[model samples]
Target: MRRLLVTGGAGFIGSNFVYFWKKKCPADLVVVLDALTYAGNIANLDAMKNVPGFEFVHGDILDTKLVERIFTDQGIDTLVHFAAESHVDRSIHGPDAFVRTNVTGTLSLLNAAKAAWLDRGSGIPHRFHHVSTDEVYGTLGPDDPPFSEETPYAPNSPYAASKAGSDHLVRAFHKTYGLVTTTSNCSNNYGPFQFPEKLIPLCIANILDGKSLPVYGDGRQIRDWLYVDDHNRGIELILEKGQAGETYNIGGSNECMNIEIVRLICDLTDLRFRERASLSEKFPKALPAAGRASRELISHVRDRAGHDQRYAIDARKIKTALGYHPKESFEAGIQKTVDWYLDHENWWRALMDTLCFSKT
Candidate 1:
């Protein structure tokens, strides 16, 4: 079994990956390192606490000493690096954190892994898998083809720029130092346990609370939506059978305009709320009212600074090479996502107080 160090294991996608890993390889030693930043919630990892072969360490990836210690102490054979300041609006307002965490933090992880896993003949064979985003390809015209691995870096936002830098660093490490590295650039992800700050969860929470569902500009920005579990499964596949020093693009093959996504969530939430309300007369009428009032709650706001208009991934390489394809269609996946938020009220209630930080 592989001994893996997963950074950012307390955040949305990372936590999903952690759960996926535990279920698939219970005997593997999985050590999670997270900074527990505003977006990182310990509750995301609550299910793994009692599971054997799993350990969580609350720490920042930028801490060189601590990262190196974990690498050496745990004999970490694989590094799945995911820690970063990922929100676009936050990056625009405070880019220093993005650069510090995404670029410098990635550099630190690469250095530590190189130091610990060099000398493969005498040490365990190791792999450094860097998780990244498709925003690094910048915006696309409505007719532009989906982004492929060869797409040149033209990141428009600070968050995307910082990730681009990290991607380049991983490539440099593989080429210059002969480090075994693989990187995956994925599209927007949505699923359960996602921080409410993101689009899907934010809309779900606001719809539930009767708050205005804010849409940026005309809300026509297009994004390919990947189910979180599908993305995690692709990562697992890469870790198992992928060639080192290669990059993979993981996508959901589901593309819709931003407004379309919000509308769908509204329709789904309304249907669910109506079903529940019919069962109990004591249930608040406002709940059903607000659910039906979803479309009216849609509000158009100023667009984000330097917001990319569109992002879509062409994931054929992974599909052709590794037989990896997304299993969830947008229709089914979104219904499940909305139902998850509705059923897990207590899980997201604690996160609602932090909504002010999620400026879209």
Candidate 2:
């Protein structure tokens, strides 16, 4: 069994990955390292506390000493690097944090891994898997083909640029130090335990609260939306059978417009309210609870600064090479996501009181 250290394990995709990994490999030791940032919630992993071989460490990835200590002390054989400052609007307002955490923090992890696994000559087989984003390819023309692994880096936002930097660092470590690394640049992800600040969760939360569903520009931006669990499955395959020093692109094969997604969430939430009488009592303020449409809250706002037009992923390499493919269709995945938020009000409500979340 692999002794794994997962960074950012309290956040959206990371937490989901942690759960997925544990369910598949019950005997493997899974240690989570998170700083408990605005997005990271320790409660995400609360269900696993009673399980054996599970450990949680509250810390920053930038702290090389602490990271190396965890590596050496825990005998960590695999490092799944997911810790990152990943909000687009936040990056636009405050880019320093993104650069510090994404670029410098990645370097720190690389150094710690190199020291613990290579420098000591322990001869332990190891791997460093870096999770990246498809935004590094920038926007796409309406008729242009989807982004492939060979797409040139042309990041438009500070968040994307910072992630691109980290991706380069991972490649450098593999080439220069032979760190046995693999990277996956995945498309947009949505599922349970996601921060309410993101599109799907944000819309679901706002719709329940009878708040405006803010749409940027014309709201026609296209994106390939990957379910969070499917993204994790791709990573699992890569870790099991992937070649070192290569990068994989993971996608959901769902290309949808922003406004279409907002409308879908609104329609789905309304359906849930209509189907359950208890929901109206729980969330009386919801428009659907009053026999009105949730889509009435739709409000068009100013577009984001430097918003990318579209992003679609060409995931053939992973599918052809390692038999990796997404299992969830958008219709089924979105309904499950909406139902999760409806059932877990306390989870997202606690996160809603934050100063940053209020502004968003």
Candidate 3:
């Protein structure tokens, strides 16, 4: 069996990818190493707790010794690194953690991978796949096309800057040391297990609780939304077929403004809840009063500092080269995501009460 070490496997995207990977390739031995930080909840991977060919390590990527030990002891021949400080607002509040986890931690992993693979020589089939975000490309104007692998680094927020630094490290390691590296810069991903701090989940959770749905600034900032499952499939494709020393851009080709996304979620929530009440004779809460649609719950707040106005990805390369196309459209994906949050309120509510997220 091929041994794979996945860092940050408890985070949203990482956890989804881990679950999908284990099911898709049952022969592969998967070991997840996560720090279990505030955002990295172990509950995300509870379903896989007893699966065969899988193991979990509660650890941080910043610890070089632990990383090296995993690589050496696990006979890890492949790496799918997803660990990073990814929240833009949190990064702004405290950039020190971002630098430590994203920049320094990435370097440590590269060094460990290089040491582990170098001794095996070039004939060995070893690879290091780095998961990244398109925020590293900074913002685009209304007329500007989507970002491609060729786009220059123009990160804006502290989170993006940290990720950009890590991307550079991956490139340098591939060029200077032949570490057999591949990187995929993806757009925003939404699905089950996403921490409630993000926009989609935050809105879903708050709307369910009858609280205000905060919208940053005018809520016109646009982002490409790729379903978490689609994003995971792209990453798996790249790992198996993408060339070494190459970067691929992954996206769903579904771009929508923040306000538009919020409205869609509101409409979906109303439909789901209204139907549920009809069948179960629950609270039977009346619809919004006149001029008070669910949209009324939207409360414009201060925009984040250095918030990117728009982010879109040019995924033509991945499409043509790898024959990859997203299976779920934005409408279908959002509905599924909304339903997941609605059905699993306890999963997210536990997180909210534990984290004590502030609406301010």
Candidate 4:
């Protein structure tokens, strides 16, 4: 059984991976290292608290000493790294954190993994799986084909650039040092426990609060959405049978415009709470004014700086090579995601209330 060190295990995608691992690889050991930043919450892993062989370390990926200690003490044989400053708007506002965490933090992990796994004479077969994004491939035209594993890196934002740098480091480590590594560049991910800043969750929360649903520009930017669970499954398959030193592109095969996604969320909300009783019972303080549909809350905001026009992934490589496929279509995935946020009102409400009180 493998002893896995999952960095950023408290974040959205990371936490989902932890749960997936528990179900798919229960016999293996999982050691989670997270800094518990604004995006990473300890509560994400609450369900796994009592599970055997699952350990959580409240720490940062930049802490070289702590990382090395875990590598040595836990005898970690697999590294699944998901920690990074991932918000594009935040990166545009302040690029320093993105550079530090996504670039420098990645370098630290690479060094520690190398020393513990390669430098030692124990001769253990280890794997370092680096999770990356398709944004590093840059924007696509309306007629352009989907991005493949061979796409050139042309990151447009600080966040994407930092990730691009990290991807390069992982590749270099494999080429120069012959480290057993596999990287997967996935498309946009949406599911439970996502921080409110992202598009889907933000829209959901805002609609519930009777607040404006801010849409950037025309909101026509296209993105390929991969439900979190599907993405996690793809990663698991890659880790199990994927060839070392190869990169795979994992996508949902579900591409929709931003405006379409927002409208769908609005419709789902309206359908679920068509009655006054349901609306009052759920939101209490944040009900839409009487007779007003949630779609009326849409507000066209200024476009994001250097936003990409479109992104699509050619995931045939993984599909053909590993027989991997996403189970959730956009229709099913969006409804399930909305249902989750609706049912977990207290969970997200606490976070929203804390932020509001802190601001005041």
Q: TM-score winner among the candidates?
A: 2
lDDT assessment of candidate 1: 0.89
Task: Show pairs that collide, candidate 2.
Answer: none
Q: Can you give the TM-score per candidate against the true fold?
A: 0.96, 0.99, 0.95, 0.96
The sequence of per-residue lDDT tens digits that candidate 1 reaches over residues 1-360 is: 899999999999999999998898889999999999889999999888899999999998888889889988999999998898899888878999999999999999998888788843437789999999999999999999999999999999999999999999999999999999999999999998888889999888777676788899999999999999999988988998899999999999998999999988878877876777642243243345543457778899998878899999999999999999888888999999998887787888798887555434
- For candidate 2, write residues 1-360 as lDDT tens digits: 999999999999999999999999999999999999999999999898898988999999999999999999999999999999999999999999999999999999999999999999988999999999999999999999999999999999999999999999999999999998999999999999999999999999888898998899889999999999999999999999999999999999999999999999999999999899899999988999999999899888888999999999999999999999899998999999999999999999998777374222
Task: Give every collision pair in model 1.
Answer: none
In model 2, which regions exceed 4 Å deviation?
Answer: 355-360
Candidate 1 — number of clashing residue pairs?
Answer: 0
TM-score, model 1 to reference: 0.96
Model 4 — which ten-residue stretch has the worst lDDT?
351-360
> Candidate 3 local accuracy as lDDT?
0.87
Regions of model 4 farther than 4 Å from truth: 275-277, 285-289, 353-360
The sequence of per-residue lDDT tens digits that candidate 4 reaches over residues 184-239 is: 99999999998877889888888888888889899999999999999998999999
lDDT string for model 3 (1-360, tens) is: 678999999999999999999889998999999999988989999999889999999998888889888887888989999999888888888999999999999999998888778844535579999999999999999999899999999999999999999999999999998889999999999999999988899887776656788788999999999999999999889988899999999999999999999999878877776557541232223233121356668899888789899999999999999888999999999999988887786789888875444432
**Which structure is stronger by TM-score: 2 or 4?**
2
Q: lDDT: which candidate is best?
A: 2
